[model samples]
Target: MRLSARSQRLLSLVALLLALLSALLGGWGYVNDSAAVLLAAPLPLLIVLAFVFGLSQPDADD
Candidate 1:
């Protein structure tokens, strides 16, 4: 899928926020195992995958 420049920028920002949220949640979970397992477990991986996919997208001009 191709994204416009604005969309690309928006996705990048979203990816950044997701990463930060994942880290914060992971750290919080580390101090509280239950929270980590229940809340932060899949977020980091999911965010990473999203970032990868977003970056891998072919350019619209391509």
Candidate 2:
């Protein structure tokens, strides 16, 4: 589904927050020696990259 500009921004913000959370989780897992953090890390990094890139583009309406 296509999101409106406001929705796109909101989604991007949420993605940013999730990315931070994932990083935190990775750090915590590292201290605890959990293997799952490795898998969890890249996906959110990629997602944050995508959302930031998408948000950086000029608005179609502008």
Candidate 3:
């Protein structure tokens, strides 16, 4: 199912925040030797990339 424009924008914003948080967590993990955080680091980035791509696409009705 497709999201409404507002929802899409919100999702992209949230994804961006998650990506930044993940980066911060990754850095913290590296400094603290936390393996779990390291493993999770890429997930948010992947999510953010997906949302960014989604945001970049022209809307279906466009």
Checking candidate 3 for backbone clashes, the offending pairs are none
RMSD of 3: 4.8
Clashing pairs in 1: none
Off by over 4 Å in 2: 29-62
Question: TM-score of each candidate?
Answer: 0.44, 0.44, 0.45
Candidate 2 lDDT over residue span 1-62, tens digit each: 34567766666676666556667767776534254454445666657655676668777799
Name the TM-score of candidate 1. 0.44
Model 1 has an lDDT value of 0.63
Query: In model 2, which residue pairs have backbone atoms overlapping below 3 Å?
Result: none
Ranking by lDDT: 3, 1, 2
Tens-digit lDDT string for candidate 1 (5-58): 677676567656755665687786654656545554555666665567678887
Candidate 2's error at 13, in angstroms?
1.0
What are the per-model C-alpha RMSD values against the true structure? 4.5, 4.8, 4.8
Give the lDDT of residue 30 in candidate 3.
46
Model 3 accuracy (lDDT, Cα): 0.64
lDDT of 3 by residue, 33-61 (tens): 36545545666666766577676877779
**C-alpha lDDT of residue 4 in model 1:** 61
